[model samples]
Target: MPDENFYLDNDDIRFNLTHMVDLESIAELKEDVGSPDCAYESADEVVETYLDLLEDPIGVLAAQRIAPRAADVDKEGCHYDNGTVTLPEPARLNVQDLAEADLMGMTLPTRYGGLNFPATLYTAATEMISRGDASLMNLFGLQGIAETINLFASDELKDKYLPGFCTGEHSGAMVLTEPDAGSDLTAVQTRAAYEEDHDHFHLTGTKRFITNGCGEVLLVLARSEDPEKYGGGRGLSLFLVEKDETVTVRRIEEKLGIHGSPTCEIYFNNSEGYLIGQRGRGLTRYVNWLMNAARLGVAAQAVGISEAAFAEARAYAQQREQFGQPLDRFPAVQEMLVRMRIDIEASRALMYATAETVDMEMLLSEKLERLDRKDPRYADLRARRDRFAKAAEVLTPLAKYYTSEKSISVTTDAVQVHGGNGYMKEYAVERLYRDARITSIYEGTSQIQIDRAIPRVMAGAFEALLDEYADRDYGTVALNGLREALAEARRSLQAAVAYVNDQKLADDQRDTDYRNLTARMVCDMALDTYLSYVFLEQARHSERKAAVAAKFIQDMAPRVEMNRQYVMSGDRSVLQQFDLLTGAQS
Candidate 1:
């Protein structure tokens, strides 16, 4: 029998999917687009059938196959031999199972043989897959490479590559990072020289820390222009290169975690390439789009890992005995378990909300592309598209930042719950802890996400969201205290935002120095309030959700106040004593 406690049995996920999100509208959109394979009469039927078809098989596979092999996969890891990268037996089998199930290219168009599900459904699947094996997500999440191709590649290129991706005959990698160009793409030095006679570009450079770099398809960012003449990002272009004799996996990194995923240092020695989209717009346009999707994928991974960690902690707390009672009977252990569970739910709430916004943005954008400007509804469609786009811009980074940080914290507590056992490889929490460490570092660091999210908060992008939450009745007397706490958190967020805005207007130097610190405080304040409201909303349907909401708000309110006070304090000691702190010569 399959484990009954797999992802499909997650009450939080089920509630969010069935009750929290607007599945009816999404179903309507999917049906209107034409359900090529399945027929359904109503929106409810469409949603129910879609969820059943996607989630059931995934849950069984995760429980019966992936979870059981995850530890061994991590142990065996990936191997490099004679320029060929090999996945461990378990990892290889995992991929084969998913491929045979036709689970890849989920969000691509049906014409490309994809399921064409919305981003919300796809994100949910990603979360489940990550829960099963965080390492495997590194491979499964590369579907973004196919989505990028579908979005930007010419028809000929799409025809050549996308079908194979849908059929699971090809996997892809986003080859962006170089030795010196980790975060700053402007420093990318890989060269792509166009050959007029051959009608193809030849790529020559080294890319470092590329996940799945050994995959069949690679989207590489290379400097197509002379660096001496056009320096920085302007010289960069996006190119699609397939595995060939010219491309070599020189070495793979021995990482701290997710060992099953190969991080390759690849050498491109005059590899054949096809340009994607326009020249010089790789970083400014295509890569930015790809990064957003990747960041969201990372957020989902974080949430899934957190859920897994929490489950391990909770189960252990219930089973482990101390002084003739379960460890869960002890107050300290109980506190840790409760906090872990709350954090997992809160992270999921934030992720699903962001995913819903992403779905709105994507579907609306696609609709606008086919819309005629002269049509009566074009203006409305355009307006909605832009609105959702802005919301996604703010929420995606916010989700990524909050969930990644929460995953680290939750996993730490999970380890703490296991005591010495968690430190040993005998338990899964040790591996989970290591896997959680990389979430905030990759797909844009937590610091980078804060910088991206701050402007959105200051510009009033989330003001309407606060108002909407404030107006909801929540339909319960017990949730009133939680509502008040949420309101207080929002006020604290606004105060922090006000302080940062004032500093920006007061002194340019001070603003530049303290912007990151200020943004961090405000972003935390916003997340606490947003998640509290989500929990309060969820409370209407489940008493368990109400308990979680109450605990979260009670714990979060004081932190929000502390951040608010720190932001308003105008303490510039870090800036004032920078040289002293660093022992620099003046």
Candidate 2:
């Protein structure tokens, strides 16, 4: 109702395409990509085609068909009865439209009936779909499952399952969690034993908290090795199992948000399964790759939700009257609106930067796999590939962490802007509020992201990345003090990271507890600095963008110091006073 085309209506998405993203650089790396449908005359042609495709079909479909149905889809939700899962009509239609549009297997090879697009495009599409309906994104975003199959599965396995996936005749579920294993996937109790007679494995175990567990295809992580020898994640191997009598959904969870998404408990009993790759590499390799994709998808989803919530709040503020004037005229309300807008913009920048980095890593892997070792370009290209690989590993988690947390803040403020009516079902922001809550919890929580990112940051990889961006001509002298301020922030951040890395922070019982305790502060400072640079990159093209950059850097300056001070102060109150503060029995 508000905007018929989500992509067309958003100027930032377009600006990123035209300004921030260097499609030519990414396309040159993909010049010889052997996928059948990946044929491109030039990088320019690819960019043009991508923009056209987004405007006509992907943009229109998400705004018109999906967003319009989101309300009813959420209300109706999924119906679970007699071990059969049925999606609400509206939700089904939302998914069917994307299927018909041939968008389901966005990044898979064309030989598998896919579009063979880059992850940046896939991620951007994910954001658009999530903007339409968070529930639909759960279903639509399952493309990662298909891509994983294409990547790791044998040619025979790919031939059997992938065409169906790309055609949208089959959907998939990533089955990893168990009752005893939520975040610690190493504790998964699922069992998959090889049956000599059948020459395949038979899976038997329970998987809990699975999204889209009712889908036709399931990628399972199970223990295939002897626990006594290869315990924990080492014993795990990835498997593919289809929906059959032996594979059943026990029950779906009643969630606080994203109600249309079916979070299920599944029981696999003697279900015939095929290994994706080598044994004992499930958690270490295959699932890790899949989870990275899943985390990036969630980041895009968070940004989309933020966009929708901000739109609703912005519209309401302009139209609604309070104290004999429009609510937007009030200084208090205006500040919230501006802050929400800036935060949303910052998160979008972070997410896309991550997505573009993933694109480089993904395409580079494809190229290097086939390149001759003696080729002239091999050495230089391999170095480039490894560099992007390192950046992608860290950025993916940061994108997921920052965008998801920002969505919570943006959505909460949206409701606050709307007053009492925002809490009611009459408005879409109510559902958006619920949908935004899950982004930070799933696909690795914010804490998990910090644990993953800080080591890489301390290794000097992320800072080197920021410095690489610094090489791009600023087009001018970073608006005078903006450059100096960013330098100071970077200095403060480096000192804080050094303090966190110091050996003196160790405790008698646990050496790394201080690092764990003060991690969020270090990560927060890093994020603020990253956001400032991201905005400055945008600030190069337009006066409006320049203003946006200044606003972000100026606002986040104090935050950078606070986090630095807290980390540098060696604050261990959480660890030192755990029992005292929490009244623990022990």
Candidate 3:
């Protein structure tokens, strides 16, 4: 029997898709391209057909197949025997069900056996799958690896790997991390050298902390340039290696959460492989693209976990009694529940917006490529493409940083709402809390996201977005106060950016020195302002969202102001007193 409580039935996702997303534009783009499998005549038809045919089935799978087995899968985890990794029986069965349903390749082109859905719909599906079992997302989300191959690999390579991916006969792993190179990927020591006699490259090195490393296809980043001749990231190149005897699974890490998702340590000993894209551009071009997509996937995963956590808390609070009344009747419990709900909605709004932008960027790029360079329409299309591309650069990191961090906080609070019961293994909140911890750590850390976002905030990328939001008028009089609050938050963000710029000019190295210290402050301000606007826009069509917007702005605007003040204070005491503060390193 299907769990009637599937998170996909949540009203907010449906509202966002129907009202907030630009489905008309997406439909027109798809129709213009004469989509092979999906040929809806109108935007409404596309949305209706997608929900009925694709999204609904995915939701059913999550409720019936995935969610029911998640706990058992966690207990069993994955097995390591000799050099092979075997998934828990429940996990293995879940994968088979998803593959048999043709749900593995949601975003790739139809010609490659994918559904060819836009990123927004794909994100929606990912959220549902993650909510069912966060560990399963590790396998389902790896479809990005296949998408990368479709985008950058040769036609020969595409024909070789994509069909297997769609058929569930193959899975993939991104093999990049080494013992010495975790966050600093440029330090990777893996070697991939061409063998003249064999006419194929041979990969040799150890890759640690690899997710799904035992999968059929592996994307490995290796040093193609000799270190003595070329150093740093310029020496790096991407390669595609299939599972063979030459590639060995050394061991799988016993992790705190997501136990069903094996994190393997792999040894590639002269593994036969083929190169991807141009040499010397792997890290800068290909891997960066892969990382951005992965980050968005993490953001969706975070949202999914939050949804599950919130549901558990809300249901428990409503049923569990204290002093002869439901716990939800208590004011303290009410506050926690409301805050968790608000955070979940805010995070979803931001995530879907980011996904929509990414979809536009991808669709426009494809359209631009198809047009003649000398065509007059090409210039306009190029401008739209670049705009969305830049938006994606800032929004992707923001979505990842904010949503992942919020998931952890929300899950912690969910446990708190459950009190002693949440600490027990019997409660789902306990597992969710553990699972939420890694979302902010991998793909890129919260600190890394702040560092990337600081320069974009400083350069006025967010300023235009803020202005656009401010200029839009909400039809309801009730939302005017929320609009004003959003305006104030935007102003506060601008002040923080101005202060950071002034500090940067005061010292030649201040940008490098002080940026990291103050980056989080700026990012918080940006997130609050951005989400406030997102919710406000959502309010135009939804009364429930109007209340969500009101509560979020009323609660969060003050914090944004406080963060701005902290940035403006220009306190350098931490940097100045580092030695004293640290007590001589021991």
TM-score for all predictions?
0.95, 0.97, 0.97
Name the lDDT value of residue 313 in candidate 2: 99
Q: In model 3, state the lDDT of residue 424.
A: 95
Error of 3 at 478 (Å): 2.9
| Candidate 3 residue spans exceeding 4 A from truth | 1-8, 31-38, 505-510
- Over 4 Å off in model 1, which ranges? 1-5, 31-40, 228-230, 504-510, 582-586
lDDT of 3 at 83: 94
Query: Model 2, 1-586: lDDT tens per residue?
Result: 6458988999988888778877777766655533465577677887787778788688999898888888998898889997898888998887788888888777887778887778888878988888989878899898999989998999998999999998889999999989998888999889999998988899999998999999999999999999999999999999999999999999998888887789999999999999999999999999999999999999989999999999999999999998899999999999999999999989988888888889888788778888899999999988988888998988888889999999999999999999999999999999999999999998888999888887787776668777865556667776555766788888898898777666462253434778777777777888888778888878888999999999999988999998888888866778888898898835
> So what's the TM-score on candidate 2?
0.97
State the displacement of the C-alpha of residue 415, model 2, in Å, after optimal TM-score superposition. Answer: 0.4
Q: Put down candidate 3 lDDT per residue, 1-586, tens digits, no spaces.
A: 6455354468887887878888668756754534554466666776665666434578888878898898998889899999989999999999999998888887777888888778788788888888989999999999889988998999999999998999889999988899999888999999989898986789999999999999999999999988888798999999999999999999999999998899999999999989898887788889999989999999999999999999999999999999999999999999999999999998898898888889889888888877899999999999988888888889999999999999999999999999999999999999999999999998889888877777888898887677778877788777876787677788788888887877754445556567678888888888888888888888888677788888988898789978988888878888888887889754
Clashing pairs in 3: none
Q: Judge candidate 3 at residue 291 and give its lDDT.
A: 89
